[model samples]
Target: MMRAELAQNFRQLELKKKLEPMLPVLDFIAWSLLKHNQDVVSQLWVLSKQQSWRTSKSIPNSLWNWICSAVDEVTLDPMTKHAWLLLSDD
Candidate 1:
């Protein structure tokens, strides 16, 4: 059990290392989507409407819902929340 847990942790660490290099590109994509695509925000909202934390089916599902809920529960606006999602590695 300990070995399995260690392997899992290592795998997650490796994945993060691989993805870290893409941060800049990801930021650019988010920025472009927000700036050039007026429909992106609505699309995100529409997608969220169809999506729920309870019914999420992905591995580590409900990530976005968790984020949005946390944001909504706080003082941030929609734009800032969206920006937070784009900037956060999680």
Candidate 2:
């Protein structure tokens, strides 16, 4: 059991390492989609998961949801929207 657990942990770590490089690109795509169409947030999440991006385990997923929910809940000015895009870029 210990050996299995250790193997799983190592696999997860390897996956994370592979994913690290793609994170910025994914974030940029998600942010750009959100800026134009709020309705596509769920689709973005689904696509991310489908691509094996581990959306639930990543910061970009949470950030995307938060920004989309905020936009849905309250009207953000253009400046605020741009700020979010800039922040997500980092």
Candidate 3:
């Protein structure tokens, strides 16, 4: 039953950075599904797809454009820098 619950909810923590100890859980999910005659490849394919875009709230194009333009690009003035300050090439 814990395996079934993990299988249902694991998608919420599937990213590489989030799942250091999750390999066994993933393996169990896949093996359990295979044992039950379910399609493992398709299930993995669905899990592998990026979900970041779906979780982020969608803003209208106009709003996005306005937000992007709200900040003015500023260049550092070397003449105004402190003598000991260093600037690195970006």
**If ranked by TM-score, best first, what sequence of candidates would result?**
1, 2, 3
In terms of lDDT, model 2 sits at 0.67
Clashing pairs in 1: none
- Per-residue lDDT over 1-90 for candidate 2, one digit per residue giving the tens place of the 0 to 100 score: 799999999999999999878876776676666766755865775576789834456456555565557654544455657644543322
Could you tell me how far off, in angstroms, the CA of residue 64 lies in candidate 1 after the best superposition?
28
| Candidate 3 Cα outliers beyond 4 Å, as residue runs | 1-15, 36-90
What's the lDDT for residue 33 in model 1?
59
Q: What TM-score does each of the candidates earn?
A: 0.39, 0.38, 0.22
lDDT of 1: 0.55
User: Candidate 2: which stretches are off by over 4 Å?
Assistant: 37-90
Error of 1 at 43 (Å): 21
lDDT string for model 3 (1-90, tens) is 698798767666566547745544554565446644435544553465444344223433433443475578778878898899897777
TM-score of 1: 0.39
Q: Which RMSD values do the candidates have, in order?
A: 15.5, 12.2, 18.6
Write candidate 1's Cα lDDT for 2-57 as tens digits: 99999999999999989866654654465455754545754674476478453324
Candidate 1 residue runs with Cα over 4 Å from true position: 36-90
